[model samples]
Target chain A: MEEGCSCIYSRMASRFSIGLLMILAIVLLMVRVLYVIYRCGKPLPKGVSQSFTTLIVLGSGGHTAEMLSLLSVLRKDRFTPRFYIAAATDNMSLQKARSFEDSVAEKPAVKEASQFMQIYRSREVGQSYVTSVWTTIVAIVHALWLMIRIRPQVILCNGPGTCIPLCVIAFVFKVLGIRWSSIFYVESVARVKKLSLSGLLLYKLRIADQFFVQWPQLHKKYPRAHYVGCLMIEF
Target chain B: MEDRENAKRVVFVTVGTTSFDALVKAVVSEDVKDELQKRGFTHLLIQMGRGIFFPTKCDGADGSLVVDYFTFSSSIADYIRSASLVISHAGSGSIFETLKLGKPLIVVVNEDLMDNHQCELAEALEERKHLYYTRPHTLYQTLKKMELESLVRYTPGDGTPVARIIDRFLGFPDD
Candidate 1:
């Protein structure tokens, strides 16, 4: 009877150890996620004269227009070798970006440092849920390939479904200590009262290093988002 | 009186990317045309976008007003720049472009649009006295009451703050 009781006790003890290990694993993961969120944006150890490689994402129509307008203000000298990525279906945005780069090139000391790339759209409007699942996976894989190839130090994107996959991969890279690709998301001026889907995900997940909203009302609702006023203005 | 009659005050009506049949239909009605003519607008240029409703009335057949339209344009900037007044659907692009050009603007909120964010922008801008907002049914009334001189000039937003944030994020010492 003593031997049987001891056997039961051993079984229970092993089960308890397994449960403890799972709890510990979950806690560690939570800590790591928090660490990556708050630990970032703390000034990196870098020289004052250092330049950064930036990836600028161009969404459709208004989003693209706003991003280009915002880009007008950023110092080209500081964000060198810029990568402008647009959805493969959107030819006009890339054309617009190229012209913008051409205009910037007119200013002396600005070299031809801009590169244009197209990635698969994560979801097309009115696509079926089943098909979208497959397409989303394809898009994510494409995004992962681009992330690995570019290994950008900074990513600037407004509200675009495509940005979600890229940002997720970037966050994973941060978690793995592969690279710290800081994400900066600017909510479109069109979004006055609420955040766009991509903006909400980035904001809630703590993936975006910096979030900006054009309207004051949005900033009030989402306290974390910086109220930067209307960004779609003449330079 | 002669100079006012001869002045080419163009009122550009744009649906912008998405279709708003109601806006197109309402603007072309007799009452709205009479209102524009009364307001001393010499031309009515409509960018109908993807709307199925083709405006057929007052296509310069009447010498009092000149009306022209196209489904789309390569760029609407030139049109907006030449226009003295703009009546636009509540698309942020159209609203900002018209405002940036310092043109008197009336934004018609499309009630059919699933997203209400567009309406929010229109309301906010209207509240600031930057522009006027109305529904298609009440556009004629809004146009009648629109005082262009009362509209406040929209000062373009500065990008310095965003630049500073980016700089700070990258660890570039504040200058």
Candidate 2:
């Protein structure tokens, strides 16, 4: 009876220890996230002005085309933004994006050092939680490598799919005192209506520093959002 | 006799995506086929997209509506040019492409059973009067009475709105 009592006590102690460890880990993670948010929410550090070298554009399909067209128009002047196109595997936009980058490289002003990262398509498996987590991990590693190599001050995101992972990496960098801003391009008013409740909640997290929307109606939706008249590359 | 025959109205059916069930229904329905035959519409050309299954015979109009499934080899611009009236799915890509060609388009919304987004897109287009929208149930009736030239013109420009939105976010000049 004493041996059984001791065994029960030991089992309870082990369980307590595991629970305690999990609680400690969660607390540490929360602290890190809070720290990141605090750091990124602030202004850039003084006397550390660097020219925007690389601009990572994240999206697939027609959204990428829209970004490339905007970049082409903007490339005419002083700002020469290098392209980092992130896409999903077997995406039609990714194939076209390669050709777009090749064509842009031919231009005198735009120096091409394009990197393509493929994320797993969510549609195939009805939202892949495991693949999503894996993609996020890979994105963080890739972002760190690119930050060290390319040294971009600005990250332009066209949509949520690719941007969400990239933005998390940006937040990590922000915590480390690396100066960067995330610019989000809003496609349509219809998109705002289509966002899932979880997505809206995530948006409130302010992963993006600035949001530009085509429709004036979105200005009401995102009070802090800027309404740009429109960006177009005239053919 | 040849001159008179050449002047017959050409009805063009363009399927932007194979997922469009309304287009399939419109083409295969016996009632619609009979009505089209009675109307003396000449040279019915059907542009089939990927994943769309075509019947061997469209009720004795086998040769009338030629199905070009996933044929990106030839430019579809030529077909849009020759079409007197263009019938298509209500995808933004198709709507813009057809409008750019200055053709009269009758857009059929792929039902909620097909895709919910199609209905939303069709509703938006109908509100703008850019194209005539046909629900799955009323597609045949809508097509029969569709007046191409009467459509309100909605010009779809380049991605200026999207660009402007991005520029604003980037803190660039709105202009």
Maximum-TM-score candidate: 1
Check candidate 1 and list the clashing pairs: none
lDDT of 2: 0.57
Q: Write the per-residue lDDT of candidate 2 for residues A160-205, one digit (tens) a residue.
A: 3655545665666665557565435344323422432223433578
Model 1 lDDT, residue A132, Cα = 86
- What is candidate 1's lDDT per residue for B1-175, written digit by digit as tens? 4664578899999998879999999998889999999988888999999999998745454566778889899789899999999999988888898999999999999999786678888898899999999999999999888898999999988888998988887777778
Task: Name every residue pair that clashes in candidate 2.
Answer: A230-B164, A231-B160, A231-B164
lDDT of 1 by residue, A32-112 (tens): 878998876565665644777889999877888899999998888788889989999888889989888888885645655
lDDT string for model 2 (B1-175, tens) is 4653576566677665345545765665767656565566654667766635563443223435322334232356677788777777765455555767777777776664532544555566666777788865787898678665678866544555544544454446556
For candidate 2, the TM-score is 0.69
The DockQ score of candidate 1 comes to: 0.56
lDDT of 1 at B144: 86
